[model samples]
Target: MRSIVIIGGGIAGAATALAAAKAGLSPVVFEAHPASGEDIGAFLTLAPNGFAALRELGVADAVAAAAFPMTELSVLARTGEVVASRPTSDSFTLRRAELCRVLQTEAIGRGIPLHHGKRLVTVREDEDGVTAEFADGESVRGDLLVGADGLRSAVRGLLDDSVVPRYAGQRVFYGHTAKAAPSEPGRMVMVRGSSVAFGYTVSPARETYWFGRTHGDELSPAEMAAPGWRDHLVELLRDDATPAAEIVAATAEPLLVTNTWDLPAVPRWRTGRVVLVGDAAHAASPATGQGASMAVEDAIVLAKALRDTANPLEVYERLRRPRAEANVAASARMTAGATDTVPRVGSARRPADGAVERMLAWDAVLED
Candidate 1:
């Protein structure tokens, strides 16, 4: 049996572990954080494509139970005019931490060994197998090593030094509030303000989850740590006659803001027995909202490749690189404000069309 060593215990890593196990491979997960629920500040939408991938992995229902459904996406202009509204294709919103917890739980229940605080420090690869050395002075050897360690991936560096994360030309802010403007359940609203792009959705419990993005220089550490971000965001929305200002003003918690970052392209995704997955390979800006979904897709496709082919790494890259890099390009355009339409909640378009759906279908045999 082939043994897989996976780095990073976030969505991509955990999902990969499950998929690999289903493919009859022995997989172990190493997480940098001490425990689950480390990054709960930000939330994301899992599109139909992502859920479809989870279904293939046999965890869709578990994820759905922890998420709030979003059925429609409505866009408003600066003058508060309804510009566009469309139905989303089976989209659900959940906090990042919640999604990670759900995936970890599902992985654990399946008896996959997941080690926390095992930050990888070095990777050694050879013709026979590969070894991963963690920060805690423990090391493990496996037939293959998968890096789902995200944008700042240590594994990616071992593959190619040219690929580095770049700013996507925007500063993103996230906040939640119960006192915001009344919203219809199952609907996500996007406000195209004069200066900022804002979106919000009310949870089943009636708490509003909202995010705003503005194109500017990246915030310094001092500016990000300083208070009064709520006031700053409210001021940016003051001139627009929309609910964004009121929603932001009513936010009681300190808003979390960070510079949007992505990798436009990677020169290499695999070297020897080590391969990259998810954001470690192809990261897109949040403007497209397909990061998590794309990661899930990667998980499924990778396991299929490994199960069906002798040269799994080469075949996996050929199958995944095109779609993943396209998403990166699309997100770059959206973050640069090149398009007027806010990418709908699920995908820029229904990426889960017939071909993609067939690709994600677990029973379908992968073609070499």
Candidate 2:
């Protein structure tokens, strides 16, 4: 059996471990956080493409149980007028912690050992195998090394110094609120404007998960901790013509503010037996709403490639590069539309439609 070491226990890393296990490679996962699922903010949308990948990994049902399916996406002008709408065939809105719990459960059930609190400091690859050095001066060796360590990946830094995460020039506030009775299940709604935008989806349990993005260098920690954050959120939503005020008013505790950033595309994602996956390879901006989906997709495709080929690194690059590039480019374009300085008349279309479909349609399962 091939030994695989995956750094980072985020969605991407967890998914990769599960996929690798199914591919006959027992993987050890290293997570920096001591606990399995930490408070990392609110819900995320797993679109059809991402959902398909999760289904392949055999965790779709568990994830679906915790998710509310999204059926439509509405784009609104800053003044609140609906500008464009798209039909989403299959998507789900679930808390990020809930989703992580599902993935972690699935991974553990498969006998994948997870080492929490192991922060990766360095990774070295040789002809024999790859070795990962931890911050505590411990080390582990494996047949392959996968960097799913998120945007600021230590693996990425070792492989390519040129790859860097760039700020998108916008700060985002994210949180979830308990919904009042009579919540409708449907598509995610985006309220777009010249200076600000709000997007949300209602979870199955009648909780509203929403996010607001604005042009700002940073948000004060005090602003995030204010008891009246909801009120300030309502003021921001007033920029939108739609019912943003209503949604903002419905929100509750633990509002989080973070600067949005994305990594520019790297020329390659592989260095010998070492490879990068998910955000480490191609971090996309949240404007595209495909980060989680893309990461799931990466795990599926990468496992397939590695299991089927002797030169896993080459195969992994060939299969992942084009798809990751498409997503990275699409994210940049989507960010431009969402944060357009000039108000546009119509809803902005996602860039490179065929690219997303191709990723979703793959059906191969790797076996050694």
Clashes of each: 0, 5
lDDT of the candidates, in the order given: 0.88, 0.75
**lDDT tens digits, residues 1-368, model 2?**
28989998989999999888877887999998889767468567776777877888889999998777787777777766777876776677777878888998889898999999898888877889889999889999998889998998888888888787887667777877776323356657777655567777666666677787777664566755667666776886665566667777776655777777787667768877788899999887777667787788788777777777676667667767776777677666666564532212121233475544443333543323
Which ranges in model 2 have alpha carbons more than 4 Å from their true place?
A: 181-183, 218-231, 338-368
- Superposition error at 212 for model 2 (Å): 1.1
Q: Tell me the TM-score of each prediction against the true structure.
A: 0.96, 0.87
Candidate 1 residue lDDT tens string, 192-307: 78888898889878888899999899888888778999999999899999899999999975788888999998988988699999999999989889999999999998898889
- List candidate 1 segments past 4 Å from native: 338-341, 348-353
- Winning model by lDDT: 1
Q: After superposition, how far is residue 341 of candidate 1 from its true place, in Å?
A: 4.3
**lDDT accuracy of residue 37 in candidate 2:** 63
